[model samples]
Target: MTTGIAARIADRIRHSGPVSVAAFMTEAMFDPREGYYATKNPIGAGEDFITAPSVSQMFGELIGLWCAQVWMDMGQPARFHLVELGPGTGQMMSDMVRAGRAVPGFLDAARITLIEASAALKMVQGRTLTPMGVEALWLDRLEDVPDGPAIIVGNEFLDCLAVRQAVKQDGHWHERMVGLDDDEDFTFVMGPRLGMDADLVPARLQDAPDGTLVEFRPGDRQLVDVLGRRFSDHPGRALFIDYGPAQSEPGDTFQALRGHEKTDPLAAPGTADLTARVDFEQLGALARAGGLDVDGPVEQGRWLKSLGLEMRAAALIRSAPEKKSVIARQVMRLTEPDQMGELFKVMTFSTPGLPKAPGFAPEA
Candidate 1:
């Protein structure tokens, strides 16, 4: 069945021309009728990957405290938005609200909003968060949330948004595309770069030699700009935790996973998880244009340590001896540079008055 899907797209390209990698990824990851995120849970043991918040409670707790700071920084707005994007199983949010109680008056002043697209995961989230005293309203887009002072968190969110790819050829960058091959299998091709993209390619990429493909996400930047502009009208901050970097570099970061195994991305359009590394630098630029104070694209390990995750973990371990192994593994996943620690980056954008956003070096 997977082979048939790949073959169909591939054959289209063979007869036609190259399709942008973005077009292919969109179909592969979100065809709705049969897409990766559309059809699969893609988390926990049965899935291709696990997210940081899922690995430990400490992660979500710290973020909870971070939001509290945003509230405090804003002089504790009587009503504010505590929003979480793509909240999975609602575990992180539950942990967040629990930890945030430490902040005096935080719970009373905030409304929890979650943007989730999966009915299956939403049910899981409902079950997990129902016990918490807080009410969580679910939505399909952040825009649905009303305008207000907000502290938003997006865990492993931006990476999954569709991205476009370009490869340097003859000192000219061409957009890499997907199309059908002779067997109707998905195939790669190059298209003439059009629109404002020619002006947007990184300066380093402009002169690169042939055969080098660069992945990018206009959708992400557009989303970032929207969120930034939305918050621009009010006072608040946004924190993004995902796999990427503080700076832009060249490489194809796209991949597919099926039951924790690497697979042909195009082979099973609806079965495998499809994702790529986020481009935080691009996000930063878009946010700035929309009028926001952008903070570090800091490494996740560094950010967690700066937030004192170690102390938090040690406290949890002391409280319960039976959970030692679980605590240890969670610590490793959040702090080990090779795991999600270093590879996953954390960044926040804020309005003018936000005190230096927690978990990173203050911007000069």
Candidate 2:
């Protein structure tokens, strides 16, 4: 039966014809009253899906240490911004804050900022961080963060940005839209052909045979543009960890997760976590164009190891010998090629004239 956001979306489509995939995703995920993120905290084992921070404290600790190193490279700014984008329940930030203590004055000289759109999740983050005496500044967009020397990090954040899909048909690319089927269920349909001047299809896919579907995020460009400008004027660095191929490829990566299982993205609007694979190559190019030095879209496993993942696991096991097996499993899950290690990628962006951030090797 039509209800909740599904009904709202159906009504909109019925009234105004088909909606682009980007518009559908924006409504289903960000609608103020009934959207998935607007209503619930979709992290942890009990929620839609688990993030790396929830998997282990080690992940967050390493990230914290990484930021500390960047802060040091920025000539130990007396005060700098330590920002996290889409901090889920504040687990990573909490861990990072704890780890930052190892670097004397690092936390003291830093201002904690979080870019979170969901009030529900913000409450959870508050609970997770308040005990540590961290009073964070929460904002709705990355652009809202105050300008200054900053160390920014985002884990599994880029994938949530809405993406538009275009399908090649009859040697022409048409924007994919969401429309109602015979059963009144949402379905994908081809819309108007993209004009050559406005075409954003990757050059490599220009001749892809008919029926090849491609996805692109307008938010990605806007985000990079903002960061490029920020880094151009300020000394700072940003790190992003997400799942996607290191190189750009054409495919439909849109899907929904509910209760840790994949579900039909169009089945229950605003009831599942919608995401698409990040295009790291594209992101890196944008960062470079924006005048920032870009680093490895490296495999997560390799990046973590370079930051001492195994060493941290050993230290944890020694402190709590009884939890050795559990710690070992977490290590494997975070670093093994078959698990998140290979699937997830890590990339960093830094202002020019600064050395490569921690965990990333010197560019050849």
Candidate 3:
């Protein structure tokens, strides 16, 4: 398969015309033949960005504990689906299964299902999960999981689902698009078109000043709806962790990363990690509409702290003096104010009958 995504995109433009920024992003990240993640590792050191699981093992361990608590709260179902929306390198799922093994009868009773889009990543996952004695299966879509009691986890998943950009101009919202500028390189342009619904534009954003561009994920609502409906039928909980604003705010969250640094998003299609921040408020409505329980839009710092990350950090630091500082720093990175603490968010959604999952409200 040709790995020249940028070239393929250029060809499309030459054949047709300018495309929307969303269309460019969709092709760049998901073209399958040579998309960024589909072709290479986009996490950690030399790549575009680092996710939570890549940050440290402790991060996954803590989430594992949270899932365990959720499962136990659900009365320890004899058969439950442990679904991870994007099991990159299978690290988080592997760490989770390892931690869950501490609980009696947990591993034997659980079925691991990974919602992954790349066959390359899935092969890597098999090497990791198979050794852990986990029977895992990967699918590109969540709906294929076959409805059941599920505990869902998506670390940095929603942001990459693709988003549309809208820039307020002349006192009205216009869908931002990608077109050939005077230089003939891709540049942003605004179309005199409104989004799905303009009347319901957040009250706070009614006065969007001209030239101020904002990005949003209509897909987030659809994802929430699917998970909410699935869990509503079987009754489960989902934990989502990602970088973004807690409340709905407007900004051009579209960003690209290459070599661990910010790059021109238009510079290289299918070669950089293109992403945007998540909007939890909008997602809350979707979950609610599906008749599920929703909680939080909390900062990752507070959520992890509330879930006892401090105690875990302190214990590990105490056990090994040599690794104390390392443990402390990881905890800070995970929950401190300046790092991922405020930038990243944690939200939980549960079925109608399920109790509020830990790490968020409904701690009942």
Q: Against the true structure, whose lDDT is highest?
A: 2
lDDT of 3 by residue, 329-359 (tens): 7887887888999998888888776776786
lDDT of 1 by residue, 40-132 (tens): 667886678888877888999999998887788888999999999889778899999999988889999988999987777778888989888
How close to the true structure is residue 135 of candidate 2, measured as C-alpha lDDT? 75
**TM-score, one value per model:** 0.93, 0.97, 0.93
Q: How close is candidate 3 to the true structure, as a TM-score?
A: 0.93
lDDT of 1 at 186: 62
lDDT of each: 0.80, 0.90, 0.80
Ten contiguous residues minimizing lDDT sum, candidate 3: 195-204
Model 3 alpha-carbon drift over 4 Å, by segment: 1-3, 195-203, 362-364
Native-vs-model 1 lDDT?
A: 0.80
Error (Å) of candidate 2 at residue 2 is 3.1
Pairs that clash in candidate 2: none
